[model samples]
Target chain A: MKQNRTMVVIFLTPALLLFFAIFVYPIARTVMMSLFSVENVTSSVSEWTFTGFKNYADLAQTSLFRKSMWNIFRIWAVGGLVVMSLALLFAVILNSGIRFKKFFRAVIYLPNIISAVALATMWLQYVYAPRWGFLTDFFSWLGLEDLAATQWTAAGNKFWALTFAYCFGMVGYHMLIFSSGIEKIPHEFYEASSIDGASKPRQFTNITLPLLKGVVKTNITMWTITSVGFFVWSQLFSTVTTDLDTITPMVYLYLQVFSTGNTVMEREAGLGAAVGVTLGLLVVLVFVLTNLLIREDEIEY
Target chain B: MSTAKREALYRSRQLNWRKEARLLPGYALLILWVIFTTILIGWVAAASLSTTRAIYRGEVFDFAKNGLNFGNYVKGWNSQNVSVFFMNSLGYASVSTVLLVLVAAPAAYVLSRFKFFLNHPIQNGFVVAMGVPVVMIILPLFAVVTQLQLLKQTYTIRLLMVVLYVGINVPYTTIFLLSFFSNLPRSYEEAAAIDGCPPMRTFWKIMLPLAQPGIVTVSIFNFINIWNEYFMSLIFANQDATRPVAVGLYSMINSMKYTGDWAGMFASVMILFMPTFILYLFLSEKIIAGVTGAGVKG
Candidate 1:
């Protein structure tokens, strides 16, 4: 399969050139853009005023940015907790030799194939609609009048409601990942345990969970990345361009760059770039930490 | 066999009432979740065929009374421009998938099969690129596109979106196909070499066809992604003529607030999802494999 130098160059040039033009260049430009105070991201560089760390300092001072940081952290931490547990539970149940497993798996994974914009809109108008919405009806039927009375889309509860819907769409995708990981474990392990007269719960704890450590780590890393990219659902949930209730770092970055409505007094592409830099660093940080902590080499399974 | 052995065998089979009962809770939970997941999409389908008043009044499932109102589809397609967006998405997704495969497959072949100086770093770069969020580069990328004067030029913007789609997907597609090419046996190439074929010819005539399944899987993944991509198109192809289904549907929903044609909006949503639904119906296995395979191995 070995090829000579000329063939290698011919084969690799297209992808390398594309990688540089689209990804490497933009990322490099983003980092550099963050260091300069530019009027418009599209403006010429001669008009740029060099600002060293001032954008980052301004971001530190901005309360909305602080709120956005907190919001994204919650999404990563809180939403991560919910999605991981639910996806794992579903994966385990389905992998435990259930009937109609394929049907259930497909139904659960259906949302993942649909556009986020469509899913978010469906959640907003159908499930979270003020009056005869599914949640309101269900809660009222359960006789939890107080819960039914609360507006799910209101400023206070919109974040949690958005998180729940997002997690609902996401769980199936992660569940499929877990299913594949669980499927890889040889059936003999379970059979041997059962023959040894071990309880099902005991077998799951001792064998299934340990074997799935790598999958769990993968799921966590993925959850972190998706939460960091949370934008569409936030935009769909909020009526305004930049609502504090659902503003993630992505939305904040968008508002800064686009400067729509009364949100941004001036176009601060530098601050927007700074936000990008921060989020980018956060992803790299999580990735490195996960790799260090997970220690894939330590587990044979 | 003794009665004790028979009893042990019966116990191991998990056919007893108590063992079956143990699975009941799990089944119940799964059934509840499945119902919850399907109901929203199902209701949307029904709503798309009902009157807007019926939907507003929560009679979406009351088909016996409200019956089917087919005008919503006509309205969405013609008046609301759903057809334009649908065609735009189909074109973008198809072209992008082809471009992605064409660009990524050869690089993957080289990276997986050849001994190159920057092989490790190149592969590592793609892996790292996957972890970085798109929002990181998007703002600056927007700047670049604007600087290129592609804004408001519908065809050029559409082309920009296609190029961006291919670029964003190149890393994952390469990595996905890399594993496929690596797992391929070396004998295929050796045979082609012995037959007096050049390496590029061998790749084009032999290896490429052999890797059809992997290429198909990667292409389907790209197609679905580019079709469903929102943020990028919302920025790049915001023009009426160039908007894809995702952005088009978003703006349609926003306008529907004033128009009050809720059923038409739902119809647009149906139009938006129909292609993917049809794809999923026929190619569920491929979609699932492409999605979960990329996640698991990568």
Candidate 2:
């Protein structure tokens, strides 16, 4: 048997071409574009004027940019905690000899399939509707008039509401990951531990958590990537363009470059590129950090 | 029938009381979650079928008075240009899904079979590209397209959207199929080669049909993704005539909110999601199996 060079080359050319055009070339250009001032997004290569790190400096000084940064950090940290714990809990429960497993899993994962726009609208328009909202209805039914009357999509609770809704949609995907991870661990470990008089919680801590180290890393990295690209939920959540409560970095970037009436005067194209690079850096940084943190050896089954 | 029922009728005889008691908390939590989920989407479904006036009056579920308003769907489909968005998405998603398989399957098969010098590097690059946020690559792609004046014309913009959709997914599709192709027994290829069948023909005739199950599962995932994709479509197809349902529905919802046509708004929400919703209804089991079994981490 021989390696067919011509066949390999012929087969791989189309994929390789797409990869270079889409991922390789664009990423390289974006990183370079971030360092310079471009006349416009459509500006040709010759129009780019070098202004090293000025875009970064400008972003640091801009308060809206700063606020967007703060908002996304909260979303990542707080929302991450909520989604991970809930996903883990649901996964554990589903794997615990429960009936209706298939039905529960499918229904729980339902929100992920729907467009985020539609899902967010269901939250903002109905769940958070001041007049006949789900929250108001439920609370009023329980005889808590004050809680029912409280506005949910209003500024005070709007950010947390956005976070909550986003977390709700995200849990199912991560739950599937954790569920599959739990299923991979042989039942014999639990059986032996139980025979030795270990409690369920003890078995979980001693066996499941350590065994799931790689999955935890995968989930964290994925969570960070999705968090960085957060846009549609925040966009649909806010009425005004610059709603301070829910403005994420992606939304800010869109407003800066893609939308009209942007406040930044010099070159929003550069600023947008800078924002992208900053986000790309965040993903890489977190990936590196999580790898260092979750350094358990992969145990073979 | 009565004896059969009576034989297993005793609650005490049929039940595992202590185990059931132990799992009671799990059931309670899950049931509460399920109930909440039901109320959330269920209310939205009900609201879509009632008039805005009834919705505001909190009479959506009071069907005895205000019966289902099927007219809301008509308004959503016709007046709002949802029909255009939906058709555009259907075109973009279906076309790109096919091209993704066509472009990716060959590369996947080659990489999985042949040990070329760049094979490992290419594989690693694609896996990393899967994790690369769209933000990183979008600006350059946008710039080049804008400079090329591709976004100006309707046809070119449509072509651009399809191309982008296919390109963005090429890595994922290729990587997914790589594992699928690798797992296939190589004896078929050997038998074909021994029979003097060329490598290329073998791939097309034998190996491809063999990989149909994997291709179908991954295609289902891809179809749902492209159908529901928002950010790229929002940027590229921002115009009234070209936008996908997700973005189209956003602008429609804004206007409808002002018009106070709440029923129409919810109805459009249904229109936006119905394709993928119906898709999942049939294939939820297959889709879930893919997610759990594979190393797909999107």
Candidate 3:
């Protein structure tokens, strides 16, 4: 085929130009901005004071920033475990010759399509409501009246509630990934294992787990991306703008750069950039680490 | 009938009681999950049609005692400015999704077809861009947009919003359609070319329409994403008339303390999500396949 350079240029220019404007330029500037002390988000590059690494140092010392970091780390670690296990379990079950697989899969993935704000509202307003909440009603019906009276929105409990809701919404996506991977595995592996009298659980460990190594890495990377961008859930779950219990780094960044929330008094835009840089670094680091750890041993069928 | 489905149907016809019994626990777990999902959305639906008093009184489901009321939707739509929010999102989502396809498809087609030096690098760049968080580039984007003063008026902000939405999703859309275009048999273009059609004409007349299924799938996906987008709109759109539903709903909820219209609030949430929810209802299988197939770049 003859190469049409003009045609390629014409087609690619729009997307390439927009990508540079939207992604490339901003990313480059953000890296620069994180190295400087700036007053506001709208401040010109001319107004920036060169303060190499100080913004990061300030964030490191700042209690709220540290707290937000800790909060997101927990979300990544603990929520990762809960989401992965449930997603894998559901995926295995759904792939195991179930009836109405599409219906169940759709229902599970329903929350992912809806607005996060709306989903969070449902959890905050109804499911976690103290009076007449779903948990309360269920517990009371089961004769656990004292357990039914628990205040889910209280300081101690809000984080778990938030994590639980977030995990529930996320399980569908990871499950679909796992299920696809599971489906791609040769049925003969399972059939032969069963013929050898291996139980289902043993088959899952020996065949399914080993085969899903790439899919597992994909899930973890996707999970990491979502966890790092955990903003809406934290904001919806928080009672205040600066709710220490629920504030992730994203909320912290929003407060520092955009909102006049009480969390940051100085409102240093540089600090926000630093937070972004830290998060971007974390994503890259995790990608690198996952790649290094889960080196794909390609197995051709 | 397909062999797989036929085989499964045949198996299902026979009373595989032992196999069914073995899978009882899986069925129970799936049923429990589906039931929870049903009740979660069901309660919200009931609350949307009930009065605040009924909701607070724990009788939203007691329809006989408290008849279903639709005044909440009316109030939410008319008085709470949800109408503006809904229209903004509808406009933004529809326009951006179309433009996204238009912009992404050509690029994807070219990248998939051509043997250019920049092909792999460009594709890799877009893939990397997918993982780049919004917070990373937001400050500079804000600075540049504000410096250009695009946020001054309602229409400009709306235009800016659409442009931003399209820009954000261009990478994912391109990557998704890249694979779709690659998988397309090149024989279509070759046939058209041999029939005296130019290369570009072949793409427009022959290939683009062939890629319609992928385009529609990704367009729906983009539509839902733009409709539910929050952080960017919250920052950029700043005004009442220009705010999309996600930001609009957030503001409404934030002000619920003073308004105290819990029923109206729930109604607005329904309005926010109903479009995407309805889309999923009719197109879940397509949307799910889109996600698991080539939707989210690994």
Candidate 4:
């Protein structure tokens, strides 16, 4: 349909304007801000000193930043592996003509609908709390006294506990994605394989795994994005603003830009911007790398 | 029976038998997962109805002895400001979803249907923007909002958050609707044109109604997102009067340290979770479709 220029502009104006204001301007400002040292994000540009790459170099030298970088990498890699495999397994099961498919899918995906704050609080106070926590009580009831006595929320175990909770909350979401992908695979492929007398495991290896490569890529990209933006859960699990055990890059960025009083190390907007930029780049890199590495031509059903 | 038919029936029956026997392991694992997830949420529900004393005594599932206390809900709602936070969350999410659909639909239609010179670039811009996480833009956005003095005024800050919600969601919403618009048959628009309707009028009067399922799906997704959105709201709408349920609930948990109102805290979580939980119970298909569609299609 040929459209008038005025009508075209009218149709597009609100979206374009909002996009520029909310996304484009802020992102551009962030890039510029990262090159200069500013005390706080709200400071005037005139107060910014040209710090060049000092902020990035400083970040490299800072042990906390290094620790956070390692923490995020572990979350992305370790959590990605666990969530993806479980999601795939569940998706495969649900697609195998199982009973209660709807009930099971909903149960798995229930955590995705709840607010992150509430889920994290539930995990913190209910599941991991030393006193009367679910794990402690369950293990003790199971007669595993040594396991029951373990302090899940203590600094030694807090990071893993946080990752475990985060992974639990995420599995349902990724499972849904995998289930949808599996649903699209025609039953004929499985039927033919079964007719050929291939074992169930063999059929999965031959048909299911290859077919799910694309969905796996999507899951990995999504996991990368979430892993990089990890914040609220970290805050809930950490004792202080700058806890080394639970802090991710996003938490570090928040502290650098916004923390005040005793929580404040120093308000360094430039460094925070650098952190944001690095995190953004890390996500993009993963996306591109995953795409490159997993270049299997998707089979169109 | 004919020999060929008898053999075919036997083969099919054998296949069914093998499938059933092989699925036992899968069933076991799935049941374990279902029980684990369900019990966690169920335990929370039970605790929300019990007193803090019973909860401390590890009587979470012991309803008869603990005596279900409905007062926790009343106290949480009235005394703890959950009602206020719930209302704020509802208002923001609904308004943002409406505004998002309003702005995104027309743009998506134009981008998908018409061939403007800049169409491809604009489309790619949105797709690229999807990869840019909110954390990247947030600090600068906060700075800008603060400089405008929007932080001091509750209403303006709320409005700003709605705007932010709409803006951040536009890329996904538009891209989502783009596929819907493109997949739609052009016959309706052609018929509308023959009947003397203008293009803009056609979009509003005819095209939109045809895409109702997609519109509803995307809007539900937007509603769930903005309702649970914490990070941006924590910065922009941090005031007690304006905080959404996500931030509100976080602060409530922190305050439990002083008050020791653990039951009230659980009740507050239930209140915060109730809307999305109910929505999920009723419209799970839409939620699943909206979420997975974004991932697989992209």
Tens digits of per-residue lDDT for model 2, B96-130: 99999999999999999998689999999998998
Off by over 4 Å in 3: A1-3, A261-264, B1-9
Best by DockQ: 3
lDDT string for model 1 (B198-229, tens) is: 99999999998999999998888889989999
Evaluation by lDDT, superior candidate among 3 and 4 = 3
* Candidate number of the best lDDT: 3
Model 1: share of native contacts present? 0.65
The docking category that best describes candidate 3 is: medium
Instruction: Give the C-alpha miss distance for residue B201 in model 2, angstroms.
Output: 1.3
lDDT tens digits by residue: candidate 3, B1-298: 9999999999888878888898899999999999999999999999999988998899898988888888888887887678888999999999999999989999999999999799999999999999999989999999999999999999899999988999999999999999999999988887887899989888888889999999989999999989989889989999999998899889798787457888888888888878999999999988998888775533
User: Which fraction of the native contacts appears in each prediction?
Assistant: 0.65, 0.80, 0.73, 0.69
Q: What lDDT does candidate 4 reach at residue B264?
A: 84
Superior candidate under DockQ, 3 versus 4: 3
Clash pairs, model 4 backbone: none
The digit string of per-residue lDDT tens for model 1 on A1-301 reads: 4446778888889899889988898899889889999888787668788999999999999998999999889878888888888988998999887777888888888899898988888898889877757888789999999988889999889999998889889998899888888898899999999999999889889888878878887888788888888998998888887799999888887787775565454678899889988988887788788888867646554
Show where candidate 2 strays beyond 4 Å: A1-3, A264-266, B1-15
Ranking by TM-score: 3, 2, 4, 1
Candidate 2, lDDT over the whole model: 0.90
State the lDDT at A236 in candidate 1: 87
Candidate of highest TM-score: 3
